[model samples]
Target chain A: MTTTSARAAAADVVIRTAGLIKDYRSARRGRTTGHVRALDGLDLEVRRGEVFGFLGPNGAGKSTTIRILLDQLRPTAGYAEVLGATPAAGGPAVRARIGYLPGELAMQGRETAGDLLEHLVRLRGGRGSGRIGPLAERFGLDLTKPIRSLSKGNKQKVGVIQAFLHAPELLILDEPTSGLDPLLQQEFLAMVREATADGATVFMSSHVLSEVEIIAERVAIVREGRIVDLDDVATLRHHAGQQVALRFADPIRADEFAEIPGVEDVEVTDHTVRCLLRGEPDALLKAAAAHHVVRWVAEDRELEDLFLDFYRVPAGELHAEAEEVVVHGR
Target chain B: MAVDTAARTPTPAPADRNGARADGTRLPVARWVLREQRRSLTLWAISLAAITAMYLAFYPSMATDEMEAVMAGLPEALMSGMGWDRIATGSGYLESTIYGLLAPALLLVFGIAAGARLLAGHEEDGSLELEGTAPVSRRQLLLERFAALTFGLFVLCAALGVATLVLAPALGMEVTSGNILAATLGLWLFVLAMATVSFAVGAATGRRALALGVGAGLAVFAYMADTIGEMMAGGDWLSTISPFGWYLGGDPLTQGVDGAGYALLAGLVVVALLAGLLRFERRDLGV
Candidate 1:
């Protein structure tokens, strides 16, 4: 049954999930067992050789989806396929082809970072320590120091190195830069780009919009256990409105600013006019030129707020859009 | 230093080079688990052996007629209840005092602690999540941990046996080498069964408190059953159900090996291990 589906899916679609649902049931104590829906009919796809961003707030099911992809957690309903095979059924065969960095990575014992990475490399069936030496150098990690003695950021560097050392076909990183400094985060981003250049697929989840904006070509914004928006990074940025606060030499009416193109939610107080401007600002600039402008300030709307706007949309409408995308193979 | 992007991104290696054998066999996780356990296993073996030797060293002085008289003066029922009925003979004295009592107690503590650390400890610390991401199945992880536990128990028992054997002749204790080996084997099997129960419970539930509670509770119940069963006639059947009963019932120190008793302990280990493996495979990890 899986073979037929695997053959049907283009090899380019490295990750595909159809109505994947994950519900975690609290232990049954008496008759009242609580069920937390971590993933609610989530349908997602990541094409081959691309860095796809998974953006969501905490408890928004980003980690749950990653766990299902890694076969760490089984979905309650629906189908999930990674690299042309069901993760649970493929087991180690599928896992062998993927490099994963968990959100909360913990290392035990007094083993040095070198020792831990060496063991992981061996477990991945890679030969020699040659790969690790280069990764350690790239991350500026001290392999000689014990893991327990390393700071959280250094430990995170170790996690990043191990994930890339195997050079697997797919990389599933959950909050990959949680403890990393900005400089190291950029280095990690470069590493991701390099991996994708070598024909690897990256599915990275993060709440940091700027980071995603910098590297991700496409992103899926998850909210309340569902993917609220999935679109090209450029298109999403184009939809983001700008905050235009204009202070005029003469008193301006709110309706005058509202008459301008691409302007919405206008507020006028005496000589000050503030409004949201979407799309091109050429028309609004010309309209402001008609009035004597004392001070003009236009700030780009935060991507975080744009994400929240998508979440604010009604679930049924978002679900319909998601379904349309799925049906049309967008 | 300038970062080398070209060097960092090497040509992708073949899929097979990552860890797969020609026959599709992989033992990396198992080997890794064993490596992690090495230091702790060594410390446990050495500590157990040293404690066993210390107990053995006191045997020579306690072997006198005066000690025998004191042992004889105790009530027969009391001596039997405490497992000290044969305190006069060197073999009986060592069996009743050390192997029968102290050894099993210490090993039980070791087994329970090690078993909890292997599964629940790793889960709680979140390391198990990273392991799960590798090309290793949950069943493989559980089995490898169980294997490490088994190996550690074997080493600890072997150390105790060697210590007793070396100290027996020098201390004038007339225990046979066969008896020492049998006693060590019996203790190892018994404690291993208990530890397997702990491992199985922890793997199934992922709750360290529950696992420790059940494992320690069963051991205490079994010990008390054996002790109480010896004092009362009607309760003899109770000892039959306890692991301690199986070990003491075999009388390994004096009677050499008890095939039936060893089989019971082995059977318990197998059943508990299977339960753990099944539960671990089915449940979500790092919860």
Candidate 2:
């Protein structure tokens, strides 16, 4: 199964991992050492020219995966390749073509944003300053202010600008919109779209479901260091469906709505009925219309709730849902 | 967006865009590291120069025969341990008082602090993640940071040497330019060896406390061994293994340069630096 998907995405596989595993050990005096498995047989693939979202909660090894891709950390077992080259073999050459923003952005020294950016450009072998002016303007960042003096949002802007200033072939951003205002977050999303439009690939990791839904075409949901669900945004939205709640003028029988298609977890209490509605809602709507409707409310199920559901269900059950989507979408 | 406009602008060719060179060499990471340490380097140089100037200025008043007689009456063991046995001669006084004990001690503090900041401090603050993600390899980053440390130490020693040279004539001291240069060179090498040890340990462990503890503990032990070893029976050989002994063992000021001692110091530096680079390359960063 892995080989089949690998062949399908062979032409444009920007990032690939095979049975990747990372383990951390802690040793204390007079006690046996303890070990934690950060990543366990994780296999993932990211394609070029696409904005791929890596979604996971804290301690899900999201940062560990990013560090491995950048060659900052070596995996305990298995392999990872970026841009068709293993990170260890082609380390500097591969990193040169990629821009990365860490989950927590911290700048050292007393250098101003301009000084640090210029220095980073030189480290990449670019002459003078490479296109920082326009980026700073877009992010509304002041170039002359010292990085330590900048607020969290402004520091994030510096991180974002540095990653984009070099115009590399790929951008790997971890929690890119963190510490930014709502308006700035929107601007950041626009910048990501602009980068993708210019034929660059973006691999972003975040726990924010709405942000990923806004920008990513596809997402890989990781749990306990392994990717459990990989699907298109539209398909996940279709499977998640909408939550429907209705209060009728007359008391309705609980079995009256039992025959409605695409409804689950139905609960009928006195004059109120609440349930999850998937697929077409026409049948549920028609059932609700049989009696005079005093108040009707149907809200789209949040992607965050769907993500929690993915976490609650067993991997085999989620795989079954994904398989159904793949069969139907094909 | 501005990115669109900048993209549309006629930029250089793809080769230039990637910032690769025909010689396959990119920009040196050392330059960036050096730039970051500029302010601290200046402060260290100035502080070292001030200390040297103060000692040189008081040489004239302390060069009297009465002072020499008083120093001579002191206990032989105590004077030898303090390195004040030769407190009358110009070169001997400078070597025993400053270069032998005080200068290296102060410079070790400087070196250890700088080394800790280079690796462990950055790691603690989470800035290493951003720096490590660049085009530079781990070996390149470690080497460049070590280069910055070496450069800063050189500047501090150079400042001290020039200040001593300028003050010698005014204070009626008969110190040769060669002696001053030799002493400064020995002090620089000693401090550099200590700093390299700190850097290597820090890079390997990625913890500031361990680096400071190990580096400082070694320095303190070496100093104690050199000072108190002379009084202990059969402890004369203790100084042989100490870095302080390797540095001041040759009496660099009066005897000119100790080629073999300098060679040993350089060798220690290389071995430690290689160990650091290897450990850094193999381990995880910002852990």
Expressed as tens digits, the lDDT of each residue in A302-329 for candidate 1 is 7877777666767778777555434443
**Model 2 RMSD vs true structure:** 3.2
Best by TM-score: 2
TM-score of chain A of each: 0.86, 0.88
lDDT of 2 at B76: 88
Clashing pairs in model 2, backbone N/Cα/C closer than 3 A = none
DockQ for all candidate structures vs. native:
0.51, 0.52
Per-residue error for B66 in candidate 2, Å, reads 1.3
The CAPRI-style docking tier of model 2 reads: medium
Please give the lDDT score at residue B218 for candidate 1: 86
Poorly placed runs, candidate 2 (over 4 Å)? A1-8, A29-32, A247-249, A253-262, A280-297, A313-330, B1-10, B13-28
Candidate 2 on A187-267: residue-level lDDT in tens? 888878777887889999999888898899888888787887777788878777888899999898989898887888799
The Cα local distance difference test for each model comes to 0.83, 0.82
